[model samples]
Target: MRLTVIGCAGSFPGPDSPASCYLLEADHEGRTWRILLDLGNGALGTLQRFIDPLGVDAVLLSHLHPDHCMDLCGFYVMRSYHPNGAAPPIPVWGPAGTAEQLAAAYGLEDMPGMRATFDFRRYPDAPAGQIGPFSFTATEVVHPVPAYALRVSVGEKVLTFSGDSGPCPALVEAARDADLFLAEASFREVDDNPPDLHLTGRQAGETATAAGARHLVLTHIPAWFDVDTAEDEARAAYDGPLDRARSGAVFDL
Candidate 1:
């Protein structure tokens, strides 16, 4: 399995990267299957550079926040009206009412609204399922909105994504024994921590340690914070292989 970082900026776009987006791909039976973890603001355009936007097999949205899902509007435009031909409906797994939230984001009526370009599936019903060669499980995390963290496994290799979560037991469970933990570090330990929204770099490291993750990749560092400082904080807590998430970085597992 291969994981590609499309964007790593938190809350909004930064000078170096866009919001949050990650691509996970695997090969099985002589065919490659690709899935996108999130499509945040400014991510769709950047995604086109990495892979054909219309070629992704599926998309899994962490939440409805603009920084995490606004690019779906632009993606809809691409899949629905590509001059050559409209792309087939792709499976989109997200929270409840995702269809309505996306419709609102696109400023459309209750009818149609991206349903033509994407097949929307709400989570928790079949939270643990298979997508091509990968098996994935979703668990509710401590975020202000209805958000989830994902654990995807191909054979024995596991990749866990802490999709916009604070310190929560669900996160720990989701990341247990993960090969790589793509955690969000949007807040600072010294800053006035908000309630049930984001995690500090130290907290992210601790979570990785608690879950026994092999490698830790700190992502979602907002532009306001120093990236080096966040890495330092995480290093103080985690003794494993640690690195900050950067656009275009690729990991093989």
Candidate 2:
């Protein structure tokens, strides 16, 4: 299994990093499965730099926020204009109103340019079974908007993503014993004390410790915060191997 950080900025796209997006790929029995965790603003372009967009098999959206989904419009354009006729429909999993939210965001229901692009399968906040080689489960998180943290299992290796959340037991429980925990460290401990919508570095570390994750990858730090300081804070709490994610960083598990 391989995990790639396509983008890691929080709230909005920074000069150095784009918004939230992660790609996970695995191959089993001669079949390749490519899954995108989030497609935040400007991520489509960054994705193109690493992998063929047409190779993406699935997309799991964490929320309806623009920074996390704006580049879905770019995806629509690619599917629409591909010279090899229309591509097969890709499974899109998200919160309850995924279809409506995406249609509205890309004007798909109303815009002809977006409507005929791809097929969409919207799943509510429930266990929606499996997608190819991955089994998935969603847990609600504390955020201004309805957000979900996802647990994805492929064979014996399980990975969890904390998609824009505050300290919550659901996240800890969902990520229990995960091989890789991709957590958001959007703020420093001092500034984000009692964080409302996002996790601080220390909070992320604590979550990884409690969940017993083998590897902790911290992401979503704002450009304003010193990256070194945030990493140190997380390190203070977590004794295990910790990595501060950077754009284009790849992890092989």
- Best of the candidates, lDDT: 1
Per residue, candidate 2 scores C-alpha lDDT tens digits across 97-185 of: 66677778766564443435544555463555576787888888898888889898888898899999999999999889999999998
**What number of backbone clashes does candidate 1 have, counting pairs of residues 3 or more apart or in separate chains?**
0
lDDT value, candidate 2, whole model: 0.84
In candidate 2 the C-alpha lDDT for residue 141 amounts to: 88
Q: Report clashes for each candidate as comma-separated counts.
A: 0, 0
Error of 2 at 210 (Å): 1.2
TM-score for each model: 0.98, 0.92
CA RMSD per model (angstroms): 0.9, 2.0
Q: Local error of candidate 2 at 89, Å?
A: 1.3
lDDT of 1 by residue, 222-251 (tens): 999999888988998899999899999999
The list of candidate 2 runs beyond 4 A from truth reads 110-116, 192-195
